[model samples]
Target: MKTKSTTLLLTAITGSLILLLGSGCGKKTVMPPETTMDGGADAGTPISYPAAEGGGYSEESLPIEGSLDDTSTATSVTAAEGMAEPTEEYKKLYGRSTRGLSPIYFNFDQATIRPDMVAKMESNSEYIRQIPNAYVVIEGNTDDRGTNEYNIALAERRAQNTKQYLVDLGTDPARVRTVSYGEEKPLFFGQDEISYSQNRRADFIIE
Candidate 1:
């Protein structure tokens, strides 16, 4: 009876050991893997961010050095600088219409050409000399300060004087015709000295 009791005790202890071992073996301890800049597999590869929906980046929104608007504005300014106003000599060389040329200004109530206008007369003569077949009509004008008849007469004198000067400078006398607009066609509508001065002038129209 004593031997049997010892055997039963030994069996119970062995069963308890087996149950603990089985329970320990059934459970598993899992550890998460380490992640680097490039996911987890490759160390040298670079990680790429997923692109947003629609377009990537606009010219106005990009982090570029110069913006598109700035570049366009710079180009426009450069183009404007390249197209400077043409000089009188350049206009003459290109045979541009005298109507497009700057008018010769005169003093108030004066039919006589001013001393300062001599250079302009010379330049006009030079332009006419270059074009032998080109005929020019000198339109004389005056401010509204004088009577219609008086202004008309003054304008005629101004036109005649301008024509004579051009003829003296080797331009053909027949090619230079004269007309008087009197106070009819004013270059400026204002009633001021500057406007009157602009109105009292001879306009050369190339024909």
Candidate 2:
């Protein structure tokens, strides 16, 4: 009887040990990366992943979308690079008129004008034509997305395209110049889609 009792106790202890081991060493689950190895996430939002069931990883609170200045480390371009400095008389007469025009937004990685934005561009052309001898500077900008070099080139294309369209609409090509600020000057500094969309545009800077 004593031998049978001892055997039962040993079995029970062994089962208890196995359960403890199983609970202590649970299987770990790893998540797949959000982007490819080359990192081709131009304007892609960073994913917010939840914690794993049994894995140990502390969550980090990163700053999200906000209406603030969030320009990256990009070199500033000068206005003189495109056009001469505005005269005091020019500023007094047409500064408010030109600066008051609303900026036209562009699509992701596109330099062409959108079908919906054609009317707005036409309005801009009319406004430019109204102000006779108005020195116009189209400042090209981009959202905080691509690399510095890529954004600069993209912005230049935007400014160039806008200038060409204005010229095509009877505006003087000599009077209109373009400067690419890339992602340096942001209208809306949020990291979300809305803010990024606002930032991707060409602004009319009356010189």
Candidate 3:
């Protein structure tokens, strides 16, 4: 009996020791890496996180569509040959007169009719003559070299001069309106003589 009791106690103690060792083995922690590598060498495996939801890249990082700007930066242009033109409406708008007559322009700084410009003005006047009720506005502008008040006066003189010329061609004076822009609206914006010359002219607007 004594021997059997001793054997039973030894078996219980052996099982308990085995259970303790197994529990301790699972509780051991793993070490992490100290540097970046392709794969993790330990339990703290390096995971690749994707770019942030909306803040990772810049517009410059995107693929360019067509020709870039003067700089190597990305710019948008027609990416495909068969793509429809984006400015089709603008081209059409400039193609024809929307109102009763197309506009007529004058020579730079000269309100006196030139022979070539007179022929074009006659054609434009015929448009109003065809539609007697048609009305138009003559807008005169000047270059940026003069004071605003002085330019306004000069522009008014040019506009009235054009209107008088049209009236002399048998168009009714009541059907015309005139406005002066006084160096306000330049056809081109630059400090050069070319731009100034462009702005020093008269244009007709039809309503």
Cα-based TM-score, every candidate:
0.53, 0.53, 0.51
Runs of candidate 3 with Cα error greater than 4 angstroms are 1-109
The TM-score between candidate 2 and the true structure equals 0.53
Question: lDDT of all the models against the reference?
Answer: 0.71, 0.72, 0.66
Q: What TM value does model 1 have? A: 0.53
lDDT of 1 by residue, 1-207 (tens): 999999999999999999998788565878645445756654555444444457553433323333223422222212323433434243323222364344576788887778898888888788777887988988898989979999999999999998888888888998989999899876567899876877788878888
Which has the better TM-score: candidate 1, or candidate 3? 1
Tens-place lDDT per residue, model 2, 1-207, is 999999999999999999998888767888755553356554355555555557644433322232123223122223335323434333323322355565777999999877886786788888877888778989888998989899999999998998898888888998988899899876566799977887788878677
For candidate 3, lDDT tens digit of each residue in 58-126? 544434454423223222354444333323232222212334443444566566666766876787788
Worst 10 residues of 2 by lDDT: 66-75
The model with the greater lDDT, 2 or 3, is: 2
Steric collisions counted per model: 0, 0, 0
Q: Rank the candidates by TM-score, best first.
A: 1, 2, 3
